[model samples]
Target: MTSNSPDRPATAHPGTPVRGRAHPPRHRQGPSPEEGELLRPLTRRQIADRMGELGELYTRTTPSGRRKPPSGRPFSSDPSALLAPSPQARSAAFLRRLAEHMRRPGFELLVAEATRPSGATVLTACAYGFPVLGDDTWWQELDGHLPANLPDLAAPGGLFVIGDILVERRVRTQDQSRDWNLARRLQKRLLSDHTAAVGVTLVDRGDTDTVAALLSWGWRCLPSADRRLLVLR
Candidate 1:
C-alpha cells in the first residue's frame, strides 16, 4: 500500500528519465512500510534478484547515484559500503549477513518501499530492527568490537533495537531544504527512545548522515567498543 504523505519534490537520477523543469516541481509521495524477513538464507540468484530491485530503486531516487565509482560500474549508494567489491558481490555478501543476523531469534528485516511511475517497486530503505529478547550472553559476541562505555541495551527488560539502517540515497538527499523528511517518516512510527534504542557500528570513514538526525531528534548517544558501536537510547 502507498503511504499518504505530504507532497515531496520529484527526484530523478541518471538512468531515470527527466521531464522539463518548465513544468514545476513534481510531487512524489512516500512509501508505506513493509515488515518481513527471509526466513532462511537465499541462494546466490535469489539474493541477486532481491538486491537488483533495491539497486535500481536507489539509483533512481538519488542524485549521487549518478556518480559512479572509478571502476565505471554501478553500485548502491548505501550498504555496499559493507565492503563488497561490486554490486553483484554485495548481493552475495548481504545474503551472508542476513543469514547471520536473521538466524538469531529476535532480529527482523524492516523495509519501506515505493512504486515508481513505471510501476516497479523500489525499496526506499531498510533497517535491521526488532525487540531485544535474547539473553545477556548476546553481549558477549559484541564485546570485542566496542570499548567499555557502551550503554547496556540488553538490560533486564529488553528494549526495541535498531541494529542498522540503510536508506536510499535519494530519499535522504533529494530535497536539501527538508533534509529530514524521510528520516522523520521512518522514525515517527518506529521509535520511542524512552523505551526503544538503536545500536550501530560506525567505522571512521562510513556515512554518518543519519547520526546527526538521530541525536538531534532526542536519542541519547553512548559510545563504546573503542567507540565503534554507537548506541542511541
Candidate 2:
C-alpha cells in the first residue's frame, strides 16, 4: 500500500497500536478512566455509520490530477485486497467485520472518535495492522523474491499499514488547528495504548514524511527498494 503523505501522516505509528498484554482484550473490557477524553474507541457499528465519511476521505487523499483508481477508489480487490479501496462500500464492509476481532493480537483495527462542541460525533482517526514474516514487504512474497535483505518483523507489534486521519472537508479548511489537534490526540492515544512492532508500508524512494512520523514514535525504518518497513521496540 503506497502510503499517502502526511498533510500526510495524521495516521501510522498508531502504527495501528495494540493494547498491552498486561490489559485484557478491549472487547472484554474498556479503557480505564484515566486514558484521556479525546481517545475513545468506537464499536464496528459506530464506524459503519460513518463509512460514508470514510469514503469521502478516500476521495480527499487522491493527489490532484491523478484519478482515484479505476474504481474511483483504491483498495479494490481488483488490484489486490491489501490495496483495497479507501472508502469503497466493500472496503468499509470488510473493515466492519474485521472490527469485531480488533482487540486480538496478529491483527488489529481501530476507529477513534471524539465529540465536537456542536454535540456532534466525529470520526477522527482509523488504523489497521497485521502480522508478517521477516521477509515480508508490501509486495509480500511476490515471485518469492525480496527487493532487498530485510530484517525480521518486530515482536509484540502488528504491521501498521493504514492510518487515516481526516475530518470533513468543510471543517478541514476552516478548522485546520482543530483538525490537527484531534488527529494528533488520536495518534498519541493509539501509540501509547497499543504496540505495533513494525509498520509495513509502500512508498517511492527517499524517506518521505510517513517515514519521519514513524521514526518520531520510536519506530525505525528498514529500507528496501520494494517497500518501507517501520520497526519498533
Candidate 3:
C-alpha cells in the first residue's frame, strides 16, 4: 500500500534514490475545509521499507535554525545533536538515526494521512519514539542533570521519549487558520499509547522556535545541566 507524493524537493539519500515523495492525497482547491487525518502505528519493517519516503520528509522538515550549541557548550551531550546536517546530508543522517532507533526494544512510529474530496490520500505528518527504560541509561546522553522528579518518573517506566514529530510544510501553510494544529494532534495521538506517562522530547539548545511551539502546546520545560539541550515534557 505504498504511495508517492509530488511537489517536494528532489533531494535523496546517497545510496537510496528518492522514488517520488509519498503524497498520502493531492492538494485540492476551493474553500472546503480540510479533512481529519488518519493516524496509524507502523511496524519496524513497514517503516524500514519507507525509508526513502521518510528520508524525503525529514529533509523537507529539517529545521533551518542555528545548529551550534549555546556559547561555551559543544552541542549538548545528546548524540542526536549532529550540528543539523547540511541539506545535502540531512536525508542520510536522518535515515541512519531512524535505523539506530528502530533497534531499540519497543520503538514505535506513527504516520498521519489525510483524504481529500477526490478520495486521494496525502501523508501529512509522523511521530516516533519509545518508552524510556527504567534503568535510566538514556539519561547519560544529556548534557546536564535532570529535575529531581524526572528520574522518579522514569523509575516506574512511566516515561516515553518522542524523538521526532514532522508535518508537511504545505499543511502548515494551509492550516494557517490554526483549525487543525496538526503537529499538536500528531504528538497527542502518539503519546496516547503510553497513557499517563510523562512524555519528553529533546530540542537542540538553539532551536527557540520549536521550543516555543512546544510551550504553546502545553509542554513544560524541564531544567537540565546546561544550555546545550532543553528537555520538554
Q: Using TM-score as the measure, which candidate wins?
A: 3
What tens-digit string does per-residue lDDT give for candidate 2 at 141-187?
23334335333333233444433433333322333234234334444
Give per-candidate clash totals: 6, 14, 12
| Model 1 lDDT per residue over 1-233, tens place | 75445444367665775554354446774432322211222343454467665444434432222233444456666865535255554445555665565555555554566666797755666555555533545455455554433335455334555555555554454542342445444444345432454443342213345554455444544544433344544
Candidate 1, number of clashes: 6
TM-score of each: 0.49, 0.44, 0.70
For model 1, name the residue pairs that clash. 62-170, 146-225, 146-226, 147-224, 147-225, 147-226
> Considering TM-score, where higher is better, how would the candidates rank from best to worst?
3, 1, 2
Candidate 3 yields a Cα-based lDDT of 0.69
State candidate 2's TM-score. 0.44
Q: How does candidate 1 fare on TM-score?
A: 0.49
Candidate models: Cα lDDT each: 0.47, 0.44, 0.69
Error of 2 at 2 (Å): 44
Give per-residue CA lDDT, model 3, range 68-117, as digits (tens): 75587666777668556676687787788889888887788988877877
Q: Name the candidate, 1 or 3, with the larger lDDT value.
A: 3
